[model samples]
Each structure stands twice: as C-alpha cells, then as structure tokens.
Target chain A: MSEPPQEQPRPEAEIDTPPRGLPQPEPAAQPPVPAADSGAAPGPGAGAAPVWGAGPPAPPTPQRRRASTVHVLQVIALVVGLVGTGWISSEHFRTVWLGSERDEPVAVDGAGAATHEGLTVSLVEATDLGATPSLPGTDWQPPSGFHAWRVVLDAESTNPDLFACDVALVDGGGRHFVANLFVDSFVDGFEWTFSCGVPEPDDDVPAQQALLVLVPADAEPTAVEITSTGFSSGYIELEID
Target chain B: MRRRWMIVGLAALAVVLGIATNVADARLLPYGPTSSTGAIGEDAGAYPFTVHVSQAQAAHTVLVCCRFETPPPTGTDGVWVVVTLSYATADRPRGASGTGLVLRSADGREFPVSNRTGSGGWLAGPDIWVRGDLAFEVAPDALEGLTLVFDPGIQLYGPMPTQYARIPLDLDPGAVLDVIELSEEQILGAGER
Candidate 1:
C-alpha cells in the first residue's frame, strides 16, 4: 500500500500517457496497484505508472482514437488475407504440379458402368488391333510399328445439356495419350465424337461411339479413362480388357 | 490546411482515373488485339491471305452456299452484311478454318460470323486465290462505320492468332434486299504471289 505512483509500471506500450515528469497526485491519494505492493510482478513496464489523476492512456482525441482502432483492424485483415492466399496457392500447386490426386479416382472394371454428373458412361468392349487394323468398308491402317486399340462406349444422359467428354488411354508404364492423338475423328463406321451423344429431347436410347487409338506396338495400354468437365472430382478409370 | 491539400489530391486522382478509364475504353490497353486496318476495295492482308473486298451489301434473307436449296431462307432478326472478297495466300498452305471474320461496330460491339449458318472453309495454297463471300448478321444501326476483322489463318484448337486485318466497309443502310444468293467458294489457282 505504500508503493509510490512513480514506482508503479505503465499498462501497455501503445497507451500514450502524459510524460512521467508531469505533476502527479499526492502520495496518499494515489491508489496502489495490488500486484506492485503484494510482492507480485507489476503490469508490463508498470514502473512508469499512469499520472495520478490522469485516467487511462488514450489517443489525443476521440477521432484519433477511432483512427488508431481502424489501423489495427486493417493490419489484422491484411495479415489474414495474405495467409489465406498463401494457403490456396499451395493447394493449387499440390493438385496441379505435385500431382497429388486429392481423392482416389472412381474406378470400374474393364466393362463396368459408372455415372458422372447426369451422364452414365458404360464401357462395352476393348479390342487390340495389332499392327495393321483395317475396317471392312475403309482402307485406313495404322502407320508402321503402331497398334490400333479400339474402345466401344455407350453414353446415355437424360439431361439435354449435352455434356462433352474426353477419352484418354494410360499405358501400363503410365504414359497417357488422348484419343485423337493417333486416331481420326471417324473410324470403322462409328464416329469418335468427343461429345456424349445428343439424346433426342424425348428419346432415351444412349449414343454409342467406337473410338480407336494407335500406339507403338511395343506399348501395353492398361486402362482407358473417361472424364467430363462437369465432374469436379477425379475422373473414371476403366480397365482395358 | 491539410484538409484543403487532401481535397486537391483527391480531385487530381479523380482526373487521372477518368483519363485512364477513357483510354482503356478506347481499346488502348496493352492486352487488347492489335489490328491491321484495311478499307473497302483495297488489298487487305488478313494473316496468310491477302483479301480484296469488292463489295459490301445488306440483305434481309441470305441463301447460304451449298445447301440453301434444302433448308431455304427465312426471316432473320438482323440484316445480313455480305462482303464479296477475293483472297490469296502468300505464305505456306493455310486452312481457312472455323469462324474467323468478325464485324466491329462503331460503338465497340463485335458480331462474329454466324456459325449457325455453317461457316467453314478448306485449304488455300501459296499464291492460290480463293473467291468467297463472308456474311455477318448484325443490327441495322451498327451498319455505320462497320469494320471487318478477318483472321483467315485461325486455328481450330490452339492459341489465338496474334493479328488480324481490319477492313472498313462502306455500307448502304437503305439497300436492304429480299435475299442475297451466295454461291460456293471458288479456289482460283495460283498466279499472283
């Protein structure tokens, strides 16, 4: 109870109180800080204690006080925004560059069926046309040292939005090739439409397409994956029979 | 005193911002397309093709080339602006693929070639002249100061072309016709390189 106001510490670094040299209250009128007199640690730098009669430290004016608070809020928001942006950028790198497949892809057997968005794609059959694959009506043949792999798929979607699809093949060694890389837009009478068939406004029959791909004869392709932009999750990997 | 200076600074900032906005609206941005301007009845180099626009006409109904007899012409919401041009490639063989012609109006609006009317093209070799009719459906009010941006060497699935020819057409708004008969595109063989 006998500790002088000059010996009491100031509350916070940012609270701007009057200079310590200013006139203070009488020793008897000055309230003692319990912690200071009770042999406990005083408030941070409480050694400079606020001037006796002067209340708590504040900005010079009410407007300045508001401005100070706004500055503190702005700093907090800027730090939070920077942290959020960094987190998103790291996640993007992981998904695109590092090839961290966020979730396991939805996989089906060689001839199984799977639904994505509103479209259900079914792999009917896959055939390996070795070296030289010639259709009955056309004379188109694979180039030298190339093997033709044919894929027949049935795409059916009741929705008229007409979702487009991409068909790709992944070899046993993990080499990926898009459908059109080796095959023409049309092959063996059936058109390799990148789009799932246009189900008539009233008809329910699915559109069937026969796609062909030419790969190096030595390469062993293991799976054909079908993906649509409509699906945000991973693509569907259908094993090659 | 500081308040007066602050007001002056704000006014200056507003003036600078207004000027910047006007410049951006005038298509002066660095990312905007660079144009190769050409006038009607002039030899305009639209990428690989040197296009010579002979005439520009307006029609209410247009019988597009090839299959006009099967589908026939019908009433359209906008007038068809047909530009009859003779083009020849000077460089290597280039395929005139996809929708490459666009009509830029006086008010900065652009109308691409009507793809629904089946606009597609074949290959033209070095020095081979091709006679074709490029038609764009546009509102009658945009006829004034209409400029055609033709990029004949556009790719079907790749990065966009860098530059295109801007041909200004001298159109007659009062000359709206019933139907314009558009014939098939003729690939006139080489002579002028």
Candidate 2:
C-alpha cells in the first residue's frame, strides 16, 4: 500500500503579493509532459513558438504593403485629376467665349443740319455695333478731324439711306462739323460707322447733347425735330470734340 | 464595378473638354467676312421694275434700268438703293483700305459722301452711285477689296432701275466670285414718297 498521504503542505511554494489591501493569489503552474504520453499536449519545443505580436519585429507582409501602396497612389491620382480638370475649365471660360462689349447711350448734338440740294442725309447711332453688318473682326476708326459719336434719326420709312453725323463746333453755333460716318439700309435693318476726330489738335466741341435728324433729298433735318433710329430706340453716344 | 465607373467618368470628362475647346475656338473667330458668289438686286417678281448689278471693281459701276409695266416714282422715298458684297469670313478687314464712300455723277465725277442717307423722298431715275472700301471679300488664301456702285436715286417702294446690267468689279486676274445677296425694306411707319 502507498504511504499514507502527508496532510502538511510544502513550504517552498510562494504566493503573489496583495498590493495594499488586495487579496493574495496562489501561483499557478502548468505541468510539462511528454508529447507521446500527453496525447499530443504542448511539448517543451511547442510552447516556445512565437505569435504575431510576441516575437522580434518583422517587416510588413508583401500583400499588405502592396495593398497600402496602391490605395495611396489612387488617392494622389484622384486629387491631381480634379485639379487639372478644374484648371482647364477655368481657362476656357476666362480666355475664350466670354466677351466684353457694351452699348451705352451717347448724345450727338447735331447730326443732319446740312442740306445741299443734291445731298440727302439721315442719322443713326452706332450703338450695338457688334450686331451691325460687317466682316467679323473689323473695327471702325474715326477720320482725321472727327470726334467719335452716335446719333438717332427718323429713319421710320427711309430706304437706300446714307448716314451723316455732325456736332456743333462752337457753343450755340449754327455751323456743325460733320462726323465721318456711313450706314447702309437693307430690308432687314441698317448698320453704321462714326469717326472719333483725329488725334492731334482734336476738336473739343462739347455736344449740347446727343441729337439726330433725317434729311431726304428735298427735306432738311433739324436737331430738335429728330426722332429715333433702328434698334437703339433712343440710345446715343455723344462725343465732345 | 468600381473600375467600370471610373472609366465612364473619365470618358465623360474627355467629352466635356472637347466641347469646351470648340466653343473657345468659335469665340475667337472673326465676325462675318464678305462673300464672293452672291449678287445684290431686287427680287425678279416683287417690284414693278428690276435692278441689276452691271459692274463691280475697285470702283463698281452698275447699269440702271426699268423693267416693268408701271413707271418708277419721281418723288422722294420712292426708290431706295444699296450695294452688298460677300466674303469668306465675317471679320473686321485690315488696313486703310477699309474707308471711303463717294457718289459719282453721270459726268464721272466723285462726291465725298459722309455716310449713308435717306433722300428726303424717293426720286425716280436710272442713276449710279459709288461706295468704296466699305465692301470687301475675305476668302481662303485671298483678301479681295471691292467697290460697290449703284443708283441711289431709285426708291425702294416705287420702282426699280430701268436698265438691265451686271456689276463691274476691278478684281485680280483669275480670281473667281463666291457669293452675294441683297434686298430692300420699307421704313417703319413711313409712306412711299
């Protein structure tokens, strides 16, 4: 028979400390066994193997690193694409189709006062010139001694009409210098030209206001009786020169 | 599925860019250039009479005639006239070659005309007038300067010029015409002179 079991515990066993007033715990130890006898239980060499976070630092896996790099590259490409598209769109609008042409009313003091027997005259304002008939990209330059201006006339029923514009040289003077201008009449409408006086010693005759009148071969147009011209119902561009 | 979406997005972007580029180019193009193949005259059946472009050149000279049953009016606003030119592009022409208009008398003398005018009323007669640099034709590989000559005395409402003719133009040798068109309109609210 086995010797009677000793009731006293061994003194070599140790207990963990109880910090301050915490309870003490007994040391727990696992028993080591041979693999063959322990039914494939962990042997001495098995438990020594390392886990992912418990070994020497390892370089990132090829699969993970490749995935991260691809994601970062894709993000960079997206940002660049957005920026490039935005830049191109902005350039197109800012430098291309957007145009700056404006029509303002200019008063031509006296447009059709001269009435030579053979000459018939009418007046038209050069506002909205962009809408007039002409070769694209053409610009009008005033003739020498002409100040640029526009007029409104009574072209209510005139055809084959030629345009002549004038402004008073002296305040309240009866004589007016004609502006170098021309307009052609067609069934649809009309377009005209006006000269801003030449550069040197420019005529500084201030127009009393913008004015227009129509003169037929037989009729002499006066400043006050002038009515209106095409499209520009009552617009004018007066130059004081 | 994500890759397909990305491809579609890129394609859409490409299309947008193409359209924008086209619009930009159009904006930069010049205005209407004068034409070369058309003629300016009355509709064959509209007026009691008809007008023809008898000649054109650096100084265009057209023949006037009355081709109708009723005679042209001899009063004001009875006849209106103008000369129109055609070009390849509608753009501002270049140089001092773009100025000057003069009405020539039967005597072959030229009068400096300030601008286009409305005769107090239409007058009837087969008369010729001349306008310069005011008309031009811009064609590929060539810029044609033109002068339009017509009868300013005939009214648009009353009658057409009495003589039949062709527009005489002073153009370079071997230069051919492209197109030109012309018409007349009654003044708003105005009676025939």
Each predicted model: what fraction of the native A–B Cα contacts (within 8 Å) does it retain?
0.00, 0.00
What tens-digit string does per-residue lDDT give for candidate 2 at B83-191?
Answer: 3322110111111112222333334544332233221112121111111223232222221333333322323222212221223333453433332222222221112
- Across all models, the iRMS values in order are 15.2, 18.8
TM-scores of all models?
Answer: 0.36, 0.25
DockQ of each: 0.03, 0.02
- Give the Å error, residue B79, model 1: 0.6
Q: Residues A45-160, candidate 2, lDDT per residue (tens digit)? A: 45533222123446999998999999999999999999998887576455543542344333433663322222222443323222222323335332222232234333222222
Question: Which parts of model 1 have CA positions greater than 4 angstroms off?
Answer: A1-241, B1-34, B65-71, B152-161, B189-193
In candidate 1, chain A reaches a TM of 0.52
Report the C-alpha displacement of residue B37, candidate 2, in angstroms.
13
